[model samples]
Target chain A: MRPPLIQLQGLTRTYGRGDAAVSALRGIDLTLFSGDFLAVMGASGSGKSTLMNILGCLDTPSGGHYGFESIAVETLNQTQRALLRRHRLGFVFQGFNLLARTSARENVELPLLYRGLPAARRRQAALAALDLVGLSDRAGHTPAELSGGQQQRVAIARAIVTDPAVLLADEPTGNLDTARSHAIMELLTRLNRERGLTIIMVTHEEEMAAYAGRTLHLRDGLIDRDSAEPDATSCC
Target chain B: MLLNALLLALREIRRNLLRSLLTVLGIVIGVAAVITLVTLGNGATLMVKQQISALGSNLVVMRPGQRLGPGHDEAGAPAFRREDADAIAAEIRGVASVAPVVSSTVTLVAGAANWSSSVTGTTNAYFAAGNWTLAQGRLFSDDEEQAGKAVCVIGQTVRAKLFAGEAPLGNTLRVRAFGCEVIGVLAAKGQGAMGMDQDDTVLMPLATAQRRLTNSRAVGTVMISLKDGVSASTAIADITALMRERRRLTTAQENNFSLMDTRQIAETLSGTIGTMTTLLGAVAAVSLLVGGIGIMNIMLVSVTERTREIGIRLAIGATGREVLTQFLTEAVALSACGGLAGIGLALLACLGLAAALNMPFLFNPGINGLAFGVSAGIGVIFGYMPARRAAALDPIEALRRE
Candidate 1:
């Protein structure tokens, strides 16, 4: 009976103008309730990344309405959108963009730093987040010193440190091997199932998409198919 | 937010320690040059003023020249006579003493030591006019001066050269054509304002020197000392009028003598030196500006190099202003560190220079503080462009950059 956490109606995104204009997103209509684990699958240039960018509040749609918990996302200015991203949305990139020279602990503390939390509290929360991602013993290691799987774990720790409303992962295992990729996917599924965290992931792997409760397939910036399980509420 | 930005900036600086040091070197040299020049210049000005004052406070020299600067036509000017000196001493109310001098370079012999020295012919009032003190023995008596007695006062240089550590009070030293008894030893006055050796001269009565050495009644210069609480300008005006009247010069004719105030000369010289210092300081400030440009250049390169990092921060919810503050803070810290190092280097250099030049090491806190403030300002001014550039970068585009 609860309202959807995110609702997108006729969403559209275009780059440039006139003859040079490239329409990245034609129109997308989607809805997802709280605690939902959704996977967005598309080939390169299929606009899945564009859609995820909009969902993360990192980019705005050229046309359409996006509402997060009844707040109009399109009406917010740059600072308001930044605040939305800071307090509500978290992102994990494919490249695992951890600060190169910084330790994993400090990397995780970054979000709390932006929140203006005190140093001591930020440290405790960052350590707890690292523990959650199973990277507690590797807190002192930098990105260069850690393996790809461990680095991705640190990135995931950074994302969840602020306890945001949703975690947005874009090809979170793109750079890892099959074994590490399965491990990371299992970690994400565990976090979703155990903690009931809302996660929207962009991945092309069918196996990765299978782990989510629902799957949305995009073809040429339009939703080709939506596979929502009949008993999604029962799983939650 | 500020504390976080500062810590980030410090960490980034430490990350690129070599580049940061190179960027700061420009500022260091600029600030050090400015401070050293200013401090040394101040000390030199003080030294010159002191030497000029040592000539005598409230003293004036009248020379027989119609022009002020060098290469003047002194041939047509009438020299002062003994009566002219006496008349000015009697007529001028503020006059303390007047000594009319005639000087000649002569070789003097004492035992096996023969040295070239200046022989000055003057009255007993020469000591008062010159503010000279006697280290030992008394000045020639009034009776001796009136009688043109062959008695002389020897300065410290002449004493050291001719006396050679032995007592010279009753010793006889040969002048140009006659022998004279050394009645007194003048205390040392070191070097004069014009770098002349003040203690390499001998003094005797004007009449005595005129008869024995030159046989000329014309005095080359007249030294006048003013009494305490008397203004030099007023005394000069009175003496000028008295000299004109005594010389029988009409209103249509120009006076043949030039009056020089030691205080005015000191002020003009010091003013010139002060202007030169400012000029040097300005030139040195240019280096600071260059240093600032270096910072901006390095910062721009850094912003470009860290595009991905900036994108990460932006995606993590850092505002453009926050990014600006971080980069600006880094630039300012770089320049401020350079400023501090420059100040230290300047102090060390100034101490060494002061010792080498035999001048006092003068600390000017105002200049030091100004240099520091300006160098920091350089950071803000030059760093803005790069910081703004970094802040303006699109997060998506930046993130895509390798």
Candidate 2:
């Protein structure tokens, strides 16, 4: 049996101090194995976003024990965490935070550049990433010229270009319309099913959550439910 | 990595061409002003020294006593006489040549055209002592000097003015009412030490000047030339002591004479010009400092603009040091472009002025290297803070920014 890719125990993420101290995540225990497409759902400020950040290594939990593929996360220094993030995780954001005034291909190449790849190799990897996103034809088109859906796809390509162990997305389809959101979710589902990649996503919409293999519901930082959606198979 | 940063920097500056040009204008004007003024000052000092050296020796002139006006003052010392001139020449130990001179302006009537010129009285030794060379014919004879004969020689400009494009040697030109024969035409002297027209003069026997022109036995002043390998200080002291003994100068009064040294004048003028050049170079350097400030200001704006970009880069595996190096490289590239433009402008200005002013073009390697080196240094110094800020940005916060 393979080790769990993500293990969170006694995760209590707090904010502020004194009487104003608020726990974003309170005493949550969770395990996510490889190839698991889990959706985290909550209302606005219900700690879904905070949970996503901690899972993606974007933010450190105030109090928690997080083990990723048997590596202790809470004990790691900043540089070590950053290195772990670079080598093991990927992130897609709601805003599609691609570099402006730069082309789709170049934006994808940015991650590889930080990887310290050679110039020619950087360009080749960027091209392959664009191809995977099916935006190879629009490789040279800047973010300003690309559509909202196309831009998000480019962002997705950048996130996965480093070939991280798991992909974590936050409100990845929040900016899209119904059809585009379905298309993006369908792309996410295909990557999980075919690549067998572990994925965790945060969203408030039940419709988007149904696409994942499992759903974890949160209310006031505590896990309220952890179950497979009845309609999850149909969406997949 | 440097190339990428530099390319971005170049693109940014290119996008803001008008502002970049305006910024460089300050440097251009400042550098041009410095180079022109400094070169002119150097040239002026050299010109003065050349004119002074052409005078041949440490020469001193006595124009009667200390003059209240421009002309001779005969109050303190009696008017210079040929007898006193002979007495000084024979008695002064360090004096090589003690020739008396009297000058007057008169119109010389040649064939048809008439030219107004000055006739100076001096002996044959005047040419050797004054460093005058003959262009044609011969110099005045010793018999002409002693017998007070009416003979004269003409300078180049006087030759041209009187002869009017004709060979003037052995020709008679009317000096006032007396006709004097031009024995020789002196070499072209261009302008004099005081920027006056030295060539526009005639040299005549000093005796002839007193006997024919003024009909007086007195001269306007005495010209004394010291011998080679002689020190003016010691000679001046000996002459002062002897002249005092001869004229009975009482201990109560000041030496009623002014001593003029060409070397002292040259040194004073050179020192003043050097000071001016230093000041001009300093002013130019101040503009470069302002240019550095402009670089800093723009870099701050760039860091703010690229904050989100910095965050994204950090998230993508870029270290803080990488981000810092990127911004620093951009700043350096910007300044390197400006520095190159400035140097080109300075060279153009230097060449233009060289041709316009007829000065020899001199390209100083030291200043050029200094300008480029200082420009790069300005980039590094001014570019640090913004680079550090970019490096220190929190990737999470920056990426989350709307």
In candidate 2, the second chain superimposes onto the true chain B with a TM-score of 0.76
Off by over 4 Å in 1: A229-236, B66-76, B211-215, B244-256
Candidates, DockQ? 0.68, 0.37
lDDT of 2 by residue, B291-386 (tens): 778878877887787788887777766778878888888777777666777777777877787778655566776676677777777779888988
Tens-digit per-residue lDDT, B17-45, candidate 1: 99999999999999999999999999989
User: Against the true structure, candidate 1 has what lDDT?
Assistant: 0.91
* DockQ score for candidate 1: 0.68
Q: After superposition, how far is residue B170 of candidate 1 from its true place, in Å?
A: 2.8
Best by DockQ: 1
Which DockQ-derived CAPRI band holds candidate 1? medium
CAPRI quality level assigned to candidate 2 from its DockQ score: acceptable
Superposed on the true interface residues, model 1 gives a C-alpha RMSD in angstroms of 0.8
What is the iRMS for every candidate structure? 0.8, 2.0
TM-score (0 to 1) of chain B, per candidate?
0.93, 0.76
Q: What is the TM-score of chain A in candidate 1?
A: 0.95
